[model samples]
Target: MDNQALSLNNTIVATNANVLSMLSERGKNIFFPKLGILAQAAQARGKAINATIGEAVEDDGSSMHLPEFDALVNMPTANIFPYAPSFGKPEFRSLWKDSIYRKNPSLKETVISNPIATNGLTHGLSMAAYLFANEDDTVLLSNHYWENYNLIFENNYGATVETFELFANGGFNVADFGKKLNEIEGEKIITLLNFPNNPAGYTPLVSEIATIVAEIKKVADKGKKVIVLIDDAYFGLVYEENVFTESIFVELANLSENVLAVKLDGPTKEDYVWGFRVGFITYAIKGGTAELYEALENKTAGAVRGNISNISQLSQSMLFKVYSAPTYEQSKKEKFDILKGRYDILRDALSNPKYAEYFSPLPFNSGYFMCVEPKKGLVAEEIRKHLLEKYSTGVIVLGSVIRLAFSAVPQAKLPELVENIYNACVDLDK
Candidate 1:
């Protein structure tokens, strides 16, 4: 009779009259305490996390001559310290165009430049939901997504987030993705695909990438609007041979006119500059006027101006300087090598026959984290809890999987971490 029992027993269908009454008054849903907490926080404009945000400066305390950084700090002309134009600085946006090409030259014909800088990728995501997604639209999400995406789409935008498996037997499962695509009975189907994916650490094979683009094209050819959002938060961190070295944006752009690809990427992970908070949103339309591009840019800027005013000009300045450096690629490669070293340790540690059968890799080829699926019959959460409470080693849990980030763990401490985790899972059978 009460709310608790109604929720547990799934007896809400009998409340049709009550639901209709509430809907007419715009009080259409029952209250949950977490939603109330969120409401209060939103009313406060995110001040709860204010003190923790640092306009952080990085220094080793040993290098007095920040030769490059000095130029970055003292030599910016327009987009430093002042308010960035709602769309962004014209110079920075132009530079961003050049940067995108340096990696994916094929985007010259397919993608357009309607970029808006956000404080971070999360802001870009919020804008994505607002600009395109209708309230009751369905978002076909990758099976293993970044955990918080649900809070944004389902909670914030009132859209259904469905899942399509990223892989089946250690590679992209074309059939699974196609099956899910067919099930969505809508003209505008939206999907969020994260590469160098969050927990799985998998990227599509070139053939698989081709298949994906082709299928999205198939959907678009049916006169449907398909928005393929490529979350490249960890772009360019490839440590393996065939796991998509190119951005998915390149693949999507090659598809039909109806396929709109939005890429959300940032300096946070790739540049090893977390506090810099420099991120951008880019749209790849099949065709558009420069003025149409400008109009979209203005709308995006409207969102930026409404949310955080603008991203810090100082961080943008610093990153632009880095992007211009001759050794930028070399510097990025050095860090990638370090990450590869850490992942190597994790791979070898897990390969020991003693622990090999307990779990499987999420086709891990790139990115900071890897997904660990429990062995047949053993649930992922049980193993995860066993590891943390028993070993004091913390890790993230995603449904029936464990997300192990090799980037955060030091090389020396890694063996111990994996050993403890494996043994914990082994102990689970007891």
Candidate 2:
């Protein structure tokens, strides 16, 4: 049978045996291609300013300024080189749960279980897709989302990707989301939410988050299985006072038995250890028993074992120490302050009157990046290429909008970055 028929018939499974078949059908995606091409160009052209990359770049254009978990570096050979358990160390899991509560105090009353270790947030998401989503399942997301999700749900799991408007009237379109949920013809539907959202770094208002939870519960009440995967890769980076401080995981977790809240987060962006590649997959199933969580853990561990055998022991050990450190909270606060300062620069720069003719900045106050919609008669790809060829500037082009990784751009160089973008618009116009 042809690939199309296989996909239509739902015969292709994302298992080791059918890997080739799955790749033939759903593996083609554009995120990595654009990222790879621009990343290579950015590196090859020395002195080029690359804002397309997502990792937290130092203000001086240096490498990621990660936390100093020096104790791990000097630890005994056994601690650094030994294999981590497939499910992660018991103490490490416990420490992570404690850290989660500290970061999200709202989750303190929302009975939850320990998180399972994954290679990173991406891996955690991939595993969740494999375990929960099936071929032909519909995974819903915001219109403004990280493109890797396409690779995870549609490409890898053979699931259908649906989207709802991320914003309406300068706020989250909760009504549209609910409408989309009801429209999807499936008993099982997955909603993947990322905040502070990538590409367009916006966190919803607290009431907006509550509306989302209520919508999910309404669907669950109608006898549909809903998986709400909270991608908190950029957690705790909110700048505005109105935005919710806690992860929406707590509220969704308390909603209904048919609703499952899966949180994917890591030290990559949170702790500034992008290279460490340490992350977690935590669960919140309403009225879930301890036994159920343990089974979920084992299944998740099995998925991890089959995929990469196990994550890096060195990374896990190092993170374990950081989680248990006496000054971990203080260290996180210091880093947050730095990112917040950079965010302020981007916010002020975007608000300048000069850029209004070029593009309109989106509503954003948190996260590492923000987005802008180019004026009419302009194409995002054309603008991106013009910026690269004419000015040696690199930014991501997503449909009609362009993303600026202000987090990667230096504070002093912010003005120059803005000038370059505006200049690119002028050059393209000419």
Candidate 3:
């Protein structure tokens, strides 16, 4: 390992041995070089005779860019063209950190590492897996998950993904979660928790969140190390009153020294900037200090530097501007209301007795989608094919369940979409 990596490992070990133990082999060897090109470039920043980096810049310290590309965005060319710091723009990182506190009020008193930018939530998860997941390591998640998780964690990193039934008795299956955690045979456990879960779109209620936290803590209490990756990609999209509005990260952050919570979230879904490809990764653990977090941040930045080098400067800059706008919250609420309207239509449509015979709707109150399992003697893929061919409707089929994205359909078209799905199932059954 490089001396810098050794130094970082020592620092992490000194602060919290459990955290150091959770790192994978690659993570242990990865370090942000303090004497590298980026470091020298930083030292030469604002110099009268600086030529440390490769990017072309005018003598007046302005970024050189084509007028055609520069005219597209209203912002300055420097913000659009410059290479963002590997950890992300300092101002933007701070702004996002503040927003986390604002959105998750329970985290105001808690201490967490500053957020580091990623290309998107998927990249954020890949980064976390790079840092913590070792070959043959088991990743626990809900059975109803985003399929890409298998590509990111298992295929990319060679980790094993074990699943627990996502729902039991019309809510989160806390018992199954605890059972799965206990079944894993190791002192180190990594789990990814995605709320407003993909496909199912279910967010746990407050009591459910409390129970989930308790279950994680139980594992931590057993002298085991736990790394919780909270994927809050579809955060702040809840339509129902009883759903847990705050992130479960708030409870997991300071739960135990044996547990480290890494939160992956960004503007993709929260601010309706899906194409921006900007996301963030944050760290928190019990008794974590500023120095400890800084060390982790450096390692995380090293990972970022090694991977994509850095996120897009234009995306980060544009989002920073959007976040600063006075109308940002109101605009987000406006969009949320539209999605909630669609959700209401789907929920009411699914409640009808006619569709229940063909398909059973899963419990869902948040996020972009909800799933339904075909009734007995019906095949989900057959229904999906029937929908596509007969009705020109598209829906995702996973095993026996079909996922419907209410977010994609117009409010007026949601009922029709649901009806088409039901018709497809009936056609397949016949």
Q: Model 3: runs farther than 4 Å from truth?
A: none
Tens digits of per-residue lDDT for model 1, 1-430: 3343234123222322211111111112221222343345446543534323213323431213335555655654334544555566667777877777777776766547556887778778877776666677788888889867888777877878999988877788777787787788866778888888888888887778888777777777887777787888899888877677878898775466566678888778888888877788887656543543444455566556656767887777778778889998898888888999998898887777776677766678789999777785788778778887899888888888888989999999888987877788878877
lDDT of each: 0.71, 0.77, 0.92
Q: Could you tell which candidate, 1 or 3, scores higher by lDDT?
A: 3
lDDT order, best first, reads: 3, 2, 1
TM-score, every prediction: 0.80, 0.82, 0.98
Winner on TM-score between 1 and 2 is 2
> Root-mean-square deviation of each candidate, in angstroms?
12.5, 13.5, 1.0
Query: Which model scores highest in lDDT?
Result: 3
Per-residue lDDT tens digits for candidate 3, residues 1-430, read 8999998888998889899989999888988889878778889887779878789988677898888985589998878998899999999999999989998999879999999999999999999999999999999999999999999999999999999999999999999999999999988999999998998999999878999999999999999899999999999999899789999999999999999999999999888889999999999999998888888899999999999999999999999998899998888898999999999988998889998788888999999999998886888888888888999999999888999998999999888888998877777666
On TM-score, the leading prediction is 3
What is the lDDT for 342 in model 2? 82
TM-score of 3: 0.98
RMSD of candidate 2 to true structure, Å: 13.5
What is the lDDT, from 0 to 100, of the residue 350 in candidate 2? Answer: 76
